[model samples]
Target: MLEKLIDDFKLQPPHAVLLALEPLRAISDYVAGIVGPAEALPRGDGHPVIVFPGLALSGAATADLRVRLQQLGYELYDWEQGVNNWPDADFDEWLQRLGAHLQRIHARHGRSVSLIGWSLGGIYARELAKKYPKLVRQVITLATPFTDTGDSTHAGWILTLLNGAAYAVDEALLKRLSVDPPVPSASIYSQTDGVVAWQGCQGKETRCHRNIEVNRVSHMGMVHHPDVLRVVADLLVEPC
Candidate 1:
């Protein structure tokens, strides 16, 4: 059943209804943010943390979570790359820019940084870890699809639309992308995720990599869901 879902590029109409409820869930998370305190998780050790927003979203999408992490005493930074629209330009050039940005963050901190990415941003974070393991202390991914990339995701059509006809990811790259990062990493996913298939969000169980599951969290709400936030906090404070 999971394999069949991954082979299908589209989601059922029922899933659309779940996606529609995201705005309300987001509002509730916002309320939770206001009424709750940052001490829900232990304070960080002052390491710099950078957050990457999901596809078609700007850093603003992660503002709430970033603020929470900030209050938890970690130096927080945004991707600052504007919207994560899959552009029509040379993909390598885009990656080069991203790599340079990560390099700059490492240089400035004078210590390895931790990366937290939401959805497509998580893919980028994992790839960065693959390329720059020494610069990254750990990684956290929220509701990211890794198994089949586009096909396994309910947002596959959106990716096809934005990324165009050449949007296919070869099997080799997919295999490479799904591997555990050199540094400690966690993939946080929700069984009820309305966007990506749950199976694709999993990692090989190992001391260095694991999948953390949350309940009743919408795909879009993962960024600010209280339970997801707590899990991220726990992962962040783990010794690397």
Candidate 2:
């Protein structure tokens, strides 16, 4: 897999570089949207929490983050669908399945759930919020690419297929599914990401969202770095 990724990078460094810039621009725009009001952060009122993983990555790989959130009085839910495989159907289809899980959590706890998606998982969580607003109280995407998945390193096969299939960036679809500004979120990205360019991790315009740039962690390490854990804990903490 590593060799394939290197080959993919060599084959498409420009694409990789462009992909990197996309996130940086997005995150920059989002940060510019600051100086506004923030939505209520979900306290430990018993909403189940879900952590989605990056492309070719899963929640198990981010066990430390999950465990840390668990310590913060939040229940972490898994996809059961496995690491971000980039579903074959519309993102909404996956959202439907995810919505079911969110509903189940809400039923037991009587509060909306929060979504924390890493890399591709973060994109998944954002798409989920669009389709099922009532189901999600908030959204958090770590090093995720909302623009075009927006980085493609090891998922070359999937990317080729999506392009052949005329896969598009459904701006209308994403807009239709959009939630209120701020969404009480946090975006954490790194500069040393070897897989997806760090630029792709910087997010875009949104109210009440925090964009944090941490150095030295690789893409995978961001999934469990101690600072990453601290961000999660703080994001989940009740507002003062």
Candidate 3:
């Protein structure tokens, strides 16, 4: 069944030309974040929030977004795993470690923690929520292509370089990733994303799940785009 879906999906990565504009668009987004009307953004309830960076990115990459969240009254935390190059360790081991970290945070706060993740990191967020649903309040994914992990993303070469010839799609994993976590979740994506296919970034919307579509935001800019930030802020404060 997974194979049939893969065959029929025909997912393709965003155009190379569009990908080329990623850096410039990201810069524009950063600038827009600076002048963005954040005063109107909703405030959080001082709950703990952990942010997971995208593939090959470090906590620094999410610094701006974290700062914004912190200013909005949320206790922000880094993934503390340095760069997100998971190839250095066993995949299951990585997840176990993250789960343990989430457990500690939940225990410390005595409340469910919200998780915000970008790109591949979003996959981790969803999986952790699934494994430890009691510890998670909600989840928000930015430009994460959790539906199909085929060549639908331009990061395939990076994966190949990280895992070498050993890199192969796990159909079961893909299917599992596509499922929404038990907690309330929102996926913020853009049709103009220039890294992963937009289709792969969306899933069926239910009462507990929603898909938000932004416009003209580069994949790399998802973290700092003003529109993206506003949507994230609104969802974070929304009652589950």
- TM-score between model 1 and native: 0.87
Ranking by TM-score: 3, 1, 2
Alpha-carbon TM-score of each model against the true structure: 0.87, 0.69, 0.93
Q: Relative to the unseen true structure, what is the Cα RMSD of model 1?
A: 3.3
On a 0 to 100 scale, what is the lDDT of residue 98 in model 3? 96
Per residue, candidate 1 scores C-alpha lDDT tens digits across 54-115 of 98899999998999899888989999899887634665666667879888988988989999
Q: What digit string (tens of lDDT, one per residue) describes model 3 on residues 55-111?
A: 889999999999999999999999999988753666677789999999999989998
Predicted structure with the largest TM-score when compared to the true one: 3
The global Cα lDDT (0 to 1) of model 3 is: 0.89
Off by over 4 Å in 2: 1-46, 148-154, 157-182
As for TM-score, the candidate ahead, 1 or 3, is 3
Candidate with the larger lDDT of 1 and 3: 3
Candidate 2 local lDDT, 92-187, one digit each (tens): 676788778777877887777888888778776777776677767777777754443322343555555645663345567545433322356667
lDDT of 1 at 179: 85
Q: Residue 100 lDDT in model 2?
A: 83
Each candidate's number of clashing pairs is 0, 6, 0
True lDDT of residue 68, candidate 1? 88
